[model samples]
Target: MADRTITLLIVDDHPVVRDGLRGMFASAPGFEVLAEAADGREAVALATRLRPDVVLMDLRMPGGGGVEAITELGRLGLPSKVLVLTTYDTDSDTIPAIEAGATGYLLKDAPRDELFTAVRAAAEGRTVLSPAIASRLVSRVRSPHGGSLSAREREVIRLVARGTGNREIAAELFISEATVKTHLTHIYAKLGVKDRAAAVAAAYDRGILG
Candidate 1:
């Protein structure tokens, strides 16, 4: 019959940012600031010990970035939902953090009310992505460059994006060197690239790899 309180662990490298967030949340209803952390590593430790319901995480920190922290939480099998609150919104930043298991993504310029709403949504295990970031993700998924590549071709492209050699990729995927070359050839054709370098760039630009 009573509303449950949502506990939060605020993670940011800046003390002032943490102070502002803490102050704001401390004044809000049905919310509690369980702890404050200056980096991703500290956030993970505090999240493990404090068992907060939600973590307001910053993506780029000095030690062990937010992506790494989010991943560690996933490995530890913690139930806390991570809400990314940071200034960065580029594809390079957003995609990895989301793929790393963040429950929500919001820009720092968000209004106070929207931020509160996002935190509550994240606490409920709901996916919250900023409008700009959401549009980019949707556009990336619907981009024309993706529809032509096969699953195997995409796998090879992903490896290539990571600078993996054909022989190494073949060994990792348990396939022969010739098969890897065939996949690369198809990837090149589908992505309209000439060589591995172009293919790698194309894959990332097309949102096939990030």
Candidate 2:
């Protein structure tokens, strides 16, 4: 390994997670954590100012979120590489993040050594993914019925799985029936199913609806 240290900016919504990561990295050699951000907006700001070699980013947050921050970093011409450190392994979560410019993806449950390796590799502009996430991506690629869906579309499908009709689903979600229909339409298109029943089955099969 090189003698130079790899600087990092840790971004996560949970203080406990940030603290854990900070302690873990602090205990390890050749890893310097410059700062921690509670949300993606703050991460983007600190990253722009600090320009750490790697950004350990959490996908879901109160603010703009990891993918948005990654996109913003690119738009601002920041050279920092982003490594997604999140719990989500779904296509809806992973695909947008990759498309938004994440250099790597690793689950929050990764072993300490693996996490360290991922960070170091990401700093060097290499791509990484946890085994589970890689499997999800591979399965998604192999199955044409598996595709990404927006939050609203997911909500619609969940209700469909619950055997709720469009009007009832709309009322439960505070959206109009037409809006629910539109969401179902989009969901069907994305999931490659022709109707609500098939959509629900595909979603459950793909782990979109639990």
Candidate 3:
């Protein structure tokens, strides 16, 4: 059987990064660069139109961030898979991207062969993570607290620690007040607390918030 070509949409804020990725994929067999987007919003629009096999997403951008775009794509029930290609591997970056429905996470420093392999795996609907990211995830899972706060939850808690109300947090995060409340509830449960104050305290104690 012939190998299938996997179509990709490359998204990054830097023009050079996009050019490099496009060039790299163009030189590789069994891959096609269908389009490129400079930020998350454009990435979503193009992905929605092209329905590519995979989306190479950057985590942070001015227009929109990768996690929000991933969430939107999942909500829209698009068939394309998202593979995060970013420099950040912190808990704040990794956990939320996975939660938002990324098929894989790879750092910019990944070897060319490794990136190609990860893109192929993502196209096959498999979960792929770099060695460092995999190790971090393993550590989180093995921690005594089975649940770790997602990036959004951490944001909400950080605001709560500063005495920010639900409405303000909703405004800041561009989410609904109800969503903010829901995140608070999840934070409380994850931190073994019963309310916002306790949740904030617990988060600080656990170094989830600075």
Candidate 4:
């Protein structure tokens, strides 16, 4: 059987960076560049239109940028897996971007091989974390602050991490969908996260989920 070909869309504000990435992926086997976007909104629009297997997204962009693009893509039920590329190595950027539905994070300085590998992995629904970012994820998961999340919140977080939607969670837990939403609202506030991916990331970070 032929190997599956992964379709990719590159989303970055810098022309030089975009060109460099396009060049790097040129020789990678079983991957195709589907489109390129100069900003987050364009990224979302293009990804939506192209329905590529993967998206290499930049974290910072002007006017409703990277994180928001990821958020919108998630809400719209787009199938593209997002891999964030950025210079910022801090937890704030990594965690939030992941929360925004990015499947992985790679630093801007990563070797071409590593970036390509990460992108391919994400296309297959796997999570990849750069070494520096992984450490922060470990530390955050081990933080004492997360102990404050309630039992119900923890349950909701578990289900969410398993990719269960609110309605399904409500059905499984024998609660109204509104109740599930309430739980998620509290979960978000307690975790200081804005979306499902972030909640899942935080849960894994804190050793609360497998």
The number of the candidate with the highest TM-score is: 3
TM-score of candidate 3 versus the correct structure, residues matched by position: 0.81
Candidate 1 residue pairs in backbone clash = none
- The clash numbers for all candidates, in the given order, read 0, 0, 0, 3
Q: How many backbone clashes does candidate 1 have?
A: 0
TM-score of each: 0.71, 0.72, 0.81, 0.69
lDDT of 3 by residue, 95-158 (tens): 8789889999999999999999999999999999999999999998887655887767878888
Least well predicted 10-residue stretch by lDDT in candidate 3: 170-179
Q: lDDT per model, in order?
A: 0.85, 0.85, 0.88, 0.81
**Candidate with better TM-score, 1 vs 3:** 3
lDDT value, candidate 3, whole model: 0.88
* Candidate 1 lDDT, 1-210, residue by residue in tens: 017899999999999999999999999998999999998789889999999999999977765578778988999999999999999887757876887799999999999999989988998898999999999989877877544675557777888878899888866654556657877887888888899999889888988788
Point to the candidate with the largest lDDT: 3
Worst 10 residues of 2 by lDDT: 170-179
lDDT of 2 at 25: 94
Q: Output the worst ten-in-a-row residue range by lDDT, candidate 1.
A: 143-152
Superposed model 1: Cα runs more than 4 Å off = 145-210
lDDT of 1: 0.85
In the range 1-210, model 2's lDDT, one tens digit per residue, is 257999999999999999999999999999999999998789989999999999999987764567778878989989899999999887767876887799999988899999999988988888999998888888776875445786557767888888999878756654446657877888888888899889989998989877
